[model samples]
Each structure stands twice: as structure tokens, then as C-alpha cells.
Target: MGLTQTGTYNTRQLQIVIINSILVVLSITAVSLRVWARRLQGLGLFVEDYLSIFALALSLGVNALLFQSLHAGVGEHVDTLSTATVEAYSLNLYVMQLFWNTCLPVIKLSIVLFYQRIFPVRSMIIACRSVMLFLAAWYIAFQTTAIFQCIPIHHEWQKKTTQGKCIAFVPFVTTLAATNLCTDVLLLILPTRQVWKLQIPWGRKVGLSAIFTLGIIVCAISIVRLENLIAISNSDITWSDTYSHLWTAIESSLGVVVSCLPSLMPIVRLVKSRGSRRDGKSLTGIGQGSSYPSYVRGPYELSEVSNRVSTGPTRTRLRAGSSHSDLIRKQAGDIEIITEIDQTVESTNHSNNI
Candidate 1:
């Protein structure tokens, strides 16, 4: 059914406010926990951390604009709103789009950078950098188009008085939504190949893959948002676009949450390890049979431990001691896989004399 602007109010206004307000609080909490996790591991912030902080800032701006639009009668029928109120809502919506556009790319970049930090293989690094470049270009192109979609910028909201041309709304939005969805899918796939190649046990590899692929939830949100965008009618925009705005807010904030999740793993491990210690349980199941001693290092940092063995040839390999699960858990951003290499080789003569 077509959306008709016959009613005085759409009850969805309250729903939008409630849903988005809760999301804002959650995103803030997720980022805070991420920072705390890093500190618990005694590590300095990296590029991904900074980018997530910046993305959270942008998300807050977007939320502010959304609330402003709601106050400006964005959920009311156009026939019920005063001309000035309509213009106010339109103006808020216009600005919110720009912020939303910028915010999504920033969130994706943060995730890509996180991948770069955790999976330091040469091919993974190259792929991540390529994705980073693509995201930067994506943001520039879409943001530029959104900024100038109307020939005279104010015409976007002041349609009556402004004599100017503007791009077709539905087609432009369709393209934007399609591209966003594509990028989301690309990001979801980027880490899976590298994850499966890890030397960890198959169960551990599956667990890590699950953590990295959490972005699929965000992608599903994007698909729903795109569908809503396609189905919306331009005439009753204030009413029809309510769901669109809701999903956009959701997708953006949820992106932040997903991006921060991996980083928050360290905190989870720390809590679990403490609880296990209190219960007098052993955390040594995964590291059994390894003769090397390994120390905890901050997630994503490489550490090496050298040992001399009298009977064996020199060998080097990735070792996870009693903290194997901790290392696996740190893939979220707190675990480090220690490298252990026997630095000394026993000479045959020395071995025979011994």
C-alpha cells in the first residue's frame, strides 16, 4: 500500500527515538570497553582504535541530527506540518545524510584497520590497505555527491523558493544504498580466508572466523535498509522515511558495536581468567605438550623467546603456552602468539661427550 499523508502523527516517532537512543548508549559503552581492554593488556592505542573513536563521534552527531529532525515534525504527515516545520525537518534530514555517509565509511575503515593489525601476514596487510584505499575513495565520491546533490545547496530543503535543479531522489539513494551494501559484503569476506589458514586447531579457527564475521549482522541490516529505501514513496517522505531513518541509525551504530567487539575480547579473557583463578581451575588445557615457556604480550604485538636445548636441532615456531585460549581470545585484540625458537644447536661431539 502507498503511504498516505492523511494522519496527524505517525507513532513510529517514539519508536525511532527509543531505539536510536538505546543504540547510542550501547555504542558508547562498547567503545569504552574496547579502550579498557587495551589498557588491561598494557598496550597503547593503534590506528583502528583512533578511527573507532572518531566514528563514534560522528555517530553521535548523526544521532543529534536525527533527534532534531524528530522534533521538527519528521514523523508527522506533510499536510499536518507547517511549511516552516517541513523545511526544518528537511534541513535536518539533509545534513543527517551527509553525517551518516561519512560515519559508515569511517566505521568500515576502522574494522579494516583492525584486521590489518591482528592478521599481520603480508597478503592480509596488502588486502587491508587496498580495502582502506577503496573505502576512502568510496567516502569521497558519495559524500561529494550528497553535498552537491542540489545545484543550489539550500534547495534541498527550500524547494519552493529555490529555483534550482536537484538529482532524482530515489535513484540517487538507490545507488548509494547498493554501494554501501556491496562494501559491507566485501568487508565480511575479507578476513575469512586468512582466518581459516591459521595454524590453530579447527575448533579455534572456527571460533576466530565467527568473531571476524560478525559484520554479517551489519550487512543484513544494510540489506533491510536498502529494501526500505527502494519501497519508500517520495510524496509522503516524512512519514515513509521514518523506517529508513531508523534502519540507518541502527546500521551505523551497530557497525560501531561490531567493529569494537574483537577488541573487547581481551577484557572477556581477563575476567574469565580471574574467575578461573578464584575457582582453583587450570587454564592449561590448550598449551599442554609444549615444552617452551611463553609470556603474555599485548594483543597484536609480536614477542620472541629464545631457549637452548642440548639434544635437538634449532627450530622456530609460533607457541601459545598456558594462554593458548587467551591468545585465541585475544584475536579480538588482546591475544598475542609468542614465537619460540631454540637459539642453540647441540654439536654432535658435545652431545657424544655428554
Candidate 2:
């Protein structure tokens, strides 16, 4: 179809295709990295991983529906399409909104569930559960409203003059956007304090906290989408709402990718390790003879425990193997016997899954 208002070609579908394509690719990469990280750690898939997968699947459904709507002339001028085409687009758009609402909350819950596992502090876990409950309630409320937004849902697709009463679009969407922003803020703050209390250094703690804080990006996108949503009117919904559509797709897709990023820490550490070895540097995160969070140490199969230093100049070691323990005992003679403590701190730091 040709452009109705501009001198340039109508590139709505093209833009949608490109954005969704990139998003799907990133989603796949994120999940792949999660699986790889899990295999490296020798653990089964966990709840949060399944939740992320569900969210990704819903996102794909939304993408496909949006593309189908475009084919039905959703992004073009309404005058350019037949009555049947318009109806098809309307139905598809409604279905897309259902999937969009579902996808956003699932992704949020996945991240929150992850926090529950990683930070077992009683207060933090309670906060995480509270947020999860809020998200679940929000999803159901918004989805139900969306379904019945108009009296006789089929009227949602009717022509402007023929369409029956529907709730005010601006208020409904604004409420949705505001709730989304609220949740984003809550999720961002949920783990910051807990992470701050970690025994790690100031810089490392900040760095770790920043990862959880990345939800602010989604909040910004939601604000942009709300702006576009407010601009939408009965005058030219399909055309005017294009920006809102664009941001919605972007926000949901970006959320999915960001949610999975924390799970990819193991792969990142591996790359850093290889680079460091090639440069002839000592391996960091391991055998440093200094205590560090196991997650920072990267997911490794090694079973070596660090030697713990006491208050004075004396130090003790934890031995895993009995034969080696005997050899060390023989060598040290009168030295204090090193009690073997299992050095494996569950590396679920990235996954935070039990």
C-alpha cells in the first residue's frame, strides 16, 4: 500500500519487522546463555528459567499478532482499507494487547522470583513475594479490563459511528502505564538494599546493584509509550498510535532480554578468563587466596577450598581429599589440623535458584 500523508514510502510494517526481529534474536541469545550457564554449573533448570521462557513465548505471540495486524492494514490510513480488513486489524490488535499484558507481568515475576532465591534474607524474600502478588493481581486486572473494555467486546471492531460504548482509552492506558512504572520502581529497589549489605567491596556492590536497577530503562520506555498513547484519538487511531505500538513492542522485548542478562554471567566470566589467560595474567575469581562471593568467582567445576586466615598470623586450610589431607598433615607436622569444609557455595548467584 502507498503512503496516505507523507511523500516517503509507508515503512510501518518494515520498522515493526526489523524491531521484532532484533528482539527475538536477543531473546533467543539470552535463553541460550542461560541454558549454557546452567550446564556449566551442572544443575537442572529452575523455576525462574521456566518463567522467563513462558514470557518469551508470550512476547513472540504478540510480535506475530502485530505483524498480522499490519497485513490487515493496521498502520495505514483507515480510508485505505476495506471494512473487512479494518475489522480483522481491530480483532488482532485486541488479541495482541492481551498477550502484551500477560508477557510484561510474567517477565517481571521471573526477575522477582530470581531475587527470592538469590537473596534469602527474610525481609527481602517477603518483599519479593509481595511484589509477585501485586504483579499477578495487576496482570489479571488489566487483562480482564482489556477483554471487556467495550460493552459487547465485538463492538470494539465496529466503525466509529456504529461502535458501542467503551471505556476511555486515555485513562485506561494511562493507568496501565502508571502501574507498569510503579512495578518497575519496586523491582528496582527490592534488591538494592540487600545487595548493598553484601560483604563485597563498595565498588563491586554498586556494580551488582546497578544490574538490578536496569529496570529504570523499562520505566523510561513506558513513559514514552504513555506519551504516544495519550496522543492517540478517535481521529486517526491506527496512524496516531504507531509510536505507542512501537514503544510497547520495544519495552516488552527489551524487558525480556534484560531479565535474562543476569543469568548470562557465567558466559561473561568464561570469556574474561580466556582473555586473561592469553595475556598471562593470574586467574581471578579463583585461587586468589582471598575470600570472594562464589558467583563472582564464576561457575566452575573445580572443588578447591580457600585457606581461611585467623585473627592472628596463623592460618588454617580446608582439605577435601583424605589422602591429600594426610600428606598435608605429614608435611605440616605440628601445624594445626585443617578441617575440611565443603568449599562449594552454591553458585546460584546468577540464577538465584535453589
Which candidate wins on TM-score? 1
Off by over 4 Å in 2: 1-9, 159-164, 279-354
lDDT tens readout by residue for model 2, 19-70: 8788778877887777776654444677999988898888878767766666
What lDDT would candidate 1 get against the real structure? 0.71
| lDDT score, candidate 1, position 297 | 31
- Lowest lDDT sum, 10 consecutive residues, model 2, at 326-335
Q: What is the lDDT of residue 99 in candidate 1?
A: 85
Candidate 1 error regions (>4 Å): 1-10, 281-354
Cα displacement (Å) at residue 278, model 2: 1.8
Looking at model 1, which ten-residue stretch has the lowest summed lDDT? 281-290
lDDT at 128 for candidate 2? 87
Error of 2 at 261 (Å): 1.1
